[model samples]
Target: MSDTGRDSSVSSPEALRSSPPVPGMFTMVLHTHLPWLAHHGRWPVGEEWLYQSWATSYLPLMRAFNTLAAEGRENLVTLGMTPVVTAQLDDPYCLTGMHHWLANWELRAREATTRTSGEDTGFAAPEAMRAFGIREREDAARALDDFAVGWRHGGSPLLRRLVDAGTIELLGGPLAHPFQPLLNPRLREFALREGLADANARFAHTPGGIWAPECAYAPGMEHDYAAAGVTHFMVDGPSLHGDTALGRPVTDSGVTAFGRDLQVSYRVWSPKSGYPGHAAYRDFHTYDHVTGLKPARVTGRNVPSQEKAPYDAERADHAVDVHVADFVDVVRRRLISESERIGRPAHVVAAFDTELFGHWWHEGPLWLERVLRALPAAGIRVGTLTDAITDGFVGDAVDLPPGSWGSGKDWQVWSGEQVADLVALNAEVVDTALATVDKALDQAASTGSWAPRDTVADQILRETLLTVSSDWPFMVSKDTAAEYARYRAHLHAHATREIAGALASGRREHAQRLADGWNHADGLFGALDARRLPR
Candidate 1:
């Protein structure tokens, strides 16, 4: 069935009868994830994604959250920060790198004001480029100032503040954001347990919900969720076959699966059509390469990069107003129609990547703030995914289809023929690492309540976990930084094999040295213990 199938078999009349007399519930879920990017590589592909998304997406998104939060807005957006990404945001090296990256952004913006144009940059008019430069320089300075004041401690403190303030409902996911369905069952559970534990270490509470790593789901995965104490998680609309009037309890488990309301979501995110592609919005692709700043407007869809018009802030603001109003109307209509059709006020979730806000779509933060503010006034009740469940927008059990939010709504992107080697690598490394770690735990066993921490085994497990991250296969299949993705996977796998070998061979000194080296390079999740790896 298509995403808009509207099949009603999933929800019976009895479930909808008790729903409250509200128009509807709406939630904007931001799945904030960037693969573990610390010490792997730098520009063009690696940690650069982390820093750019930090500056453009995270910082501005936080600003919006803080501003709305100050106004006493609660349950605004359910934000998911993957444990791997959160680790980097809290990592010391990453903090320092971000500080420098912010400074460089400022310098680059200032440079745009004075630099001469080459053949590539010649498309940028002098005055227009200077205006863009001046604006960017000011924004960069403000970002740097925000970083100095609010982010100096790292992402944990910032996220903790949001959590404490009760402005956002946080969602946690597995460490490294692995595709859980394809993972070894023991390793899968281990990663998720540690991932939520990692969340507790920072946020002081394990999130009741998760983003489910690409919204990927398998038949029995809900059992794992129930075991993990998760109340809810997200999947794409098609997974529920568009009978998403309410959250569905998966297989009689208490865990609820909220399907994305694609009708409302695609209004802003669709490739064929969306607000960001509007002509007045700043063009995301065309750039003034001289200073690495984009100075063009998306004049038309088919327009060439050089031929695109110069960006106008006022024009973009006007376009945002128009789009915001359009979205509010869309939500209003969807709520009314769905409620009437389903015999109750329905639940709608529009989940998107958090990075799309400021990093990919330059004017996205402004649009987000405007639309969020406009929703309640337009008579729509907006809340987090948990709030939707609490509001009684829930239905009968669903034997959810195996699916993902990726291309074709299947696992092929992460487990396909083109990446067959990577799939094999993941299976091999997990088996070897698990067997080796189990043996090491036996060697390091203790009579006390706590098993002594095994740095060597922990390092081996760490590398093994990193090697199986979904990002490598996704990148390889998508051809976006395919080389770097493959390299990272192999690098971690190699580290895992070498360390596991040294420890298994009883070369204690050699294993310790290898553990020390890899830990410095990939020392995320400081709380990881070898004893925790066994099923």
Candidate 2:
């Protein structure tokens, strides 16, 4: 580990204030990701996930970024748009379905207002329901209008505008958000390359940074990253074994790994405590079953769902103000201490999932906007990871240990006894898919009749990639919709096997049928060509 030389001379507050300002940099990284959910299922666990997140999180976040950009706030944060999530956002099915979902949300909110007194049996009282309904109705209306104006041509236009305006530094990742540490090396490289290509094709700008799905890594992966043209990526703070206050270049590689600042980041979100748990914020778990909207506040952790108080926007806004100030103080104090300790400026990188704002925590977006504005006014420098590097925050090279952001900061969440079956299944599916595709390509080349690109081969790769998504094992470990996650995983695995079997048996007609059926159901990556797979 490299020593951050400590300077004890500038100890007093007055001296610190009088001295030239240390080049303290603050960068917020938001990882936006979701598995390929389009055309899979619709109601409880499938496409609805896409539409709900799009309306509540993606739309509102874009609006927030645009607002800041309009005020000349450049490089406010780093936004990661995984290729799989981007694909769904730009899919015609998802776009149309989202519009329809928003329209229905408005109707549902309107209906809630007129429900009979006895029918309002949710945690919120009738009057509270009416208030919540009206607010939701207006929100849905605004979102619908925004969608029509900005997202009709898919999210690419809106996202491109953000990048072009310098509002955010976009980060791209693997095509399917596969757990790269466990993936076959050939497929891993292929996914990374294709993912970058997808982002360039959509945004007309290639990202120099990547999110490194789940921050999961094994030794030597840095070589793969450098080869794929990635200059920087993120890993959990503990991956550095506690020396995570600054970005560090991997051993001998130009690529840098920025570690998440757990102290600052966990102030807003953590497994045990965070701003979202405030008494006045809307409770994510409790909901009004009638309208499928959350209508209660988290009165207390021990309080039963039925005993929670009805959510009040006024109270939540007050909480946002309080937490925002507290967060700003935390950042300020951290920078001062670290700068003094390192004898120079320090960089603080706080990262979180993008869905935490607006989707999981209703007041999160408001808190974000307030924090962005407050930090600059308080003399705190805010910038993206690129800006931090330019400001000289890079440290000496270190070999990172094998780990992820999961519990215990190890691979157990992905490869534990609880998910051993999934691990085995993934290994089998990926190996079979690769062998099948290579064989098919070789046979086609020798015959010289048809092109090497086979629909069956394409579908096999698609399903195989889908099977390898990290979400299934995570959901299973967390027990949050584990059944649905398993169903999705197995469904794709079965499809891969069926398609590969048909192709291997020389049953072209049967293989085509399987390809068409799977394509109609799980298609999102229209640009994926199996011929690109390494032979």
Candidate 3:
């Protein structure tokens, strides 16, 4: 999912399982993802991205989901966590790093309390700053406590608990969150297999579905889904030609493509005016540099950061109230309207990035909690993507055009002119990885003895996979962090070339040494088998 901006387990909703699928069924799908950030840069962009989302979004979202489950809400939402992000979430290194990050957060908040007054400091008033600091410190402490109880051993355990309890219908995905349409058939198959296997390995439960990266799709990709035993995936509304009343079976396959109802989704993410942009909500961008806290409301779109009004909890609360009511109304009205328009009951999916909640829109989780509650009260039925399909929401098949939920609802964002060089770089990397690994396996076969573990080949595949993540081109094209994106693409590509070259030169010792060094950073997918890279 895209932020355009931007959970623990509990009981399965067995209690709510019998609620008949009603018309106007709504599924709120959240795709939780971030590239592998460990050992990468920090500060402006890097591992901090993980920490910020973990503390602000993940923890709060988990609270919301758990609270709902505790209240007996099941089929709450369909969630997709890409394997790349899950790897970091489960890493011991990242768990330790996040603990320290939360500690620093509280320290920063406490330090901000020492300031005496605001005066004309271009920051909030001294009293306001002190209060903000105190509140932040408490938040940090609670977050730290949450981490200790649930995340001490890394996220897999918590996630597994949720899965086993039937709290969520986890979506299967590829290992690195690669944009599958662009990958070669073999690599695409490999990525999907590895991703699903990773899910099974981590949670011991294999998901039948996935939130396709970027909701990106192309014709016949459904075959790959079926081959990998993927039963369902998400696509954009336009991919289904705006008839998102139900999930469509793609091209005679059992794999279902659930189109995100943009009518419902864009309500929160609209570029022009979405709920998050409301003036009364806390602003996402403005900040108090010394305190590392956001103390301003979005007083106005054009308002200078310093001139923005101080964040008033009451004001933000009211905005949340209004927006929650408005969103509920929107979903209810859309469902009623679409059901009427289609002359039948309809299914609507409003999907987004999980970070958009606490990380981008501070009140998002509360707003979400309220909306989910209000929807059922208003007689609007809710279910997961699976529920919709099982409840007979499947519709006519669609020959999905090539598209993504990104900018143009097309592939340009990942393959446009600006990043042509990187695209070529990816092709080079993939082709070389296949050939090198294929050759090594062929030689091993001919010698009548299997190669001793092919560490070099494994590293080559790892670097190659990292090099082609859809994120790099996306960042470069969006100019959000273009330089960092370029540097990373080159970094992984360089690693792959050097190691592959060493292996090709019969210098097994040299290749093994290079692979060892790269493992410190890109080491992931321990079960990865270069032999899986078939012709």
- Score every model by TM-score: 0.94, 0.93, 0.94
Could you arrange the candidates by lDDT from highest to lowest?
A: 1, 2, 3
RMSD of each: 5.7, 5.2, 5.2
CA lDDT of each candidate?
Answer: 0.86, 0.86, 0.83
- Model 1, total clashes: 0
Minimal lDDT window, size 10, model 2 = 1-10
Tens digit per residue, CA lDDT, model 2, 1-535: 0011112331333333344433588899999998888777887788888887888899898888899988999989999999998888888888888999999988988877775677754577787788888888888899989998989899988899999988999999988899999999999998898899999999999999999988998999999999999999999999987666679999898899999989999988965678888888888889788888778888887889988888888888877776766676677778888888877788888999999998898888888987897777667789999887777798899998899999998888899999999999999999999999999888878887666568888888888889999999999999988999999899999999999998888898999999999998867777788878865
Candidate 2 TM-score to native = 0.93
- Residue pairs in steric clash, candidate 1? none
Which pairs of residues collide in model 2? none
Model 3: residues >4 Å from true position, as ranges?
1-22, 118-121, 449-452
lDDT of 3 by residue, 1-535 (tens): 1111210121112322333434669998999989888898997989989999988898888878788777887777788989988888888898899999999998988886786864343658888777777877898899989988888887777777666666667886887878778888888888888888888999898988998888888888899889889889998888888999988899888788998888889889876778888887788899887767887888877888989887778877877766666676677778878899988899989989988989999999898888787678667788888888888988887678899998889999888999999999999999988888888878877877665567778888889889999999999999989999998889999999999998888987998899989986657888887777656
Which candidate do you rate higher for lDDT, 2 or 3? 2
Worst 10 residues of 1 by lDDT: 1-10
